[model samples]
Target: MDIISCLPGHVIDRILSYLPIREAVRTSVLSKIWKNKWYTLPNLVFDKHGVSDVASEDSLVDKNKIVKIVDHVLLIHSGPINMFKFTEDDVIGEILVTDMDRWILHLTGRSIKELVLEFLTGEEEEEYYKYKIPWCLFSCQSLHRLTLQWCWLNPPKVFEGFRNLRSLDLNLVTVAQDAFENIVRDTSIVLKNISSRKGN
Candidate 1:
């Protein structure tokens, strides 16, 4: 009926892909055609502290809301998620770790190419713990680029995967020397570039 609405579904999906995850998701309510477009988006971002300047109470509410939104997106997303980015906060606590494991496991089922996971820094409470990058990541053969900031790395003894990985960046991550070497040894064939906070 409308010129904009008549555009090809792929074209529409491409256009919607550029917008922020939240804004893109909102477009779903515009009509039935656009209702499920968000689910097919290949890229999804969840920045937990989007409203940092807001009051303390409001920020907590927004953070919790973000966690719930992430749950829904990862669960219902129907298309292959090429990239996934999320910011973790300590306020969410131990529950967030379980949720992240589940999320990563879900992504492994698809052909994910790029993964960026950053944890919020500054609070002393959150300082006590760092979310360990799941061992399952080593088995993700589709992963080409990976980045982790303020997270922990514990490579498993049986680690053997990421043959497609080309770039890896680990910033401010606490990792054992031998464990780190193990990761490099496994991916040395295809991994060309790697930078970690501990080293130059």
Candidate 2:
């Protein structure tokens, strides 16, 4: 008898959730009981750099692979997604932005809590162009922590701040003072830490 298999499905799912997506997915080959177990994970971290071992910074192959893997994983995800972090960009294919919005909108519908959007590509301008967050994020009351780097922040006029957000970290991002003020004034977020930095 397999002792590990005796554990509840939720407990095994929680353990798999902490592993990197690649590792988590690879576990499906272990046995019948392990097949599709990762679909229950609530946390999803899609870091492009970690997705491959390639050392070349300009590898379009890596970028394409990252996009394909992300699309596949999100499509098969069956359980509630509590957190989603996507941090990377470079010569994105024609459908990158549209695909990203589809993924972001999907997570929003799942009541995602912790969201992180970081663009660390060498080009700052392209990063901004690719990281335009979805409109749904502004009204996502389920969000509890948000971290944005090398992206623009344009909270909508009718935006009510993240009601559950406890931490906000923005670095090298563009955010107007008025939009920020609206969130502080209108939203009930008990922010524990709020820090932002600008690029030179």
Candidate 3:
């Protein structure tokens, strides 16, 4: 048996967290001891380099593959997801929103601590198409840090705030004056850092 495998399970999980998510999952093939160890990995990152399968000479990513990969991982994930980061610039119009909504719905009850959702597009088209984040995201009280880029933020009228959220980073996001006021003015939240901007 390897010396590293003998280390405590928490130590192993910590070690795996440092590796790229793809490499971390590949560790399951190393041996029986490592099998399924990644299922409990708290941090999940889905980005171009990590999950993309370039489909053609044009260098476009296969969106369907990415969606399937996310679905499979979340379906089998066994423990609370402390952090989930998803960055995809090639997400097609409305399809991406559906998948994102479902994923957020799944993560809500899992006590996710940090959430990052970024979708990049051509600057000209960006203003016309901003992802409206799923309403469930605003209800996630476990979120400690939230970063959203190139999306529209319109929380429900009854929404209060993320009670545990300490940091909020909004880049190129559009929120109505009333909605923005409601989010920042909540007494229940003591945000340590709040950054917002209107993109050109």
| Winning candidate number (TM-score) | 3
RMSD of 2: 3.5
lDDT of 1 by residue, 52-130 (tens): 3322565556556666788888878898899998876543357577888888888877879999888865443454467
Alpha-carbon RMSD of each model: 3.8, 3.5, 3.0
Models ranked on lDDT: 3, 1, 2
Model 1 score (lDDT): 0.72
lDDT of 3 at 79: 86
Candidate 2 — which residues are off by over 4 angstroms?
A: 48-50, 53-58, 89-95, 121-130, 186-200
Residue 130, candidate 1: C-alpha displacement in angstroms: 1.1
Candidate with the greatest lDDT versus the true structure = 3
TM-score of each: 0.82, 0.81, 0.86
Number of clashing pairs, model 1? Answer: 0
lDDT by residue (86-147, candidate 2, tens digit) is: 87755344556677778878888889999887775335545445356667888788888888
lDDT of 3 at 108: 90
Worst 10 residues of 3 by lDDT: 191-200
TM-score result, candidate 2? 0.81
Predicted candidate 3 versus true structure: per-residue lDDT over 1-200, tens digit per residue: 87866878888888888887778888987777788999998999998767644444442236666777889899989988999999976534666678888999999979899999888844745566777788898898998888887777888889877778877778777775578776766555554434444332
Candidate 3 at 61: error in angstroms? 6.0
